[model samples]
Target: MHRTPTRRQIQAKLSTMPPQRSQATAYLNAYKMMLEKERLEEELDKLEVRRHQIQQRLAILNSQTIPEGDMTHQQANTNLEDNTPKFKTLTLEY
Candidate 1:
């Protein structure tokens, strides 16, 4: 099976390359890393926005008053617990 090269193997290969080629390779890798960093930053911004939206939604839900009188606080709490929205777990990968 094919496998990724180790850091030592990569360094050895780079050392054998001409200086200009080595420098070009380094520059290309740095450019790619910068692109990746920007992409990750944008993703983080989107996630933060989504988090804030969810928090606002939760606050609105919490602020809503259950009708008072007929039911005791414990009963209202139980009803809220029973009706609470269920969320599926999500797995994220880089």
Candidate 2:
């Protein structure tokens, strides 16, 4: 199976490379850096989306009105806990 290379492995390989062909090495390193940048940008996008979604949920929750009555704290807590929505989150791994 093909596995992704770790930053440490890439750095070690680059360090031990023969320094004469610097141009080729630079191009290859640039490509790897670009890939890493793209991956981070994608993660940032996912985080932005998740943030927006959470904000929307919070707005909805804040706008909700509760009936006024002599209710106990336990009942209100239960209602809040039961009605709150659970969301799936992004899992990032190298």
Candidate 3:
């Protein structure tokens, strides 16, 4: 005949186990690593958002004025001649 251990007996047995201590330590280390990774990712996201905001601000500051009516300056002009070499000529010569 075999007897089943009670809940208190099982708890007492678990308290003396070395493997349980090691398992707890491993779980703690894994949790710490996960937290550190999450913190770093959050920092990276903040930096990326700041960078995007700076880029938008810079674009607004560096905005150019567009001229109205019959002026080629507002549009890019490319030579359609196949034999002509590409040059860095401005659409409107100031």
**Cα deviation of 19, candidate 3, in Å:** 15
Alpha-carbon runs more than 4 Å astray in model 2: 1-21, 65-94
Per residue, candidate 3 scores C-alpha lDDT tens digits across 1-94 of 8798665521211224354457878896677679777887999999999999999987776563223332454343433335576677668766
* Worst ten in a row by lDDT for model 2: 63-72
Candidate 3 accuracy as lDDT? 0.64
Off by over 4 Å in 3: 1-21, 64-94
**Residue 42, model 2, lDDT:** 100
* lDDT accuracy of residue 49 in candidate 3: 100
lDDT of each: 0.73, 0.74, 0.64
User: Where does candidate 2 clash, by residue pair?
Assistant: none
How accurate locally is residue 93 in candidate 2, as Cα lDDT from 0 to 100? Answer: 100
- What is the alpha-carbon lDDT for the whole of candidate 1? 0.73
TM-score of each: 0.49, 0.49, 0.45
Best by lDDT: 2
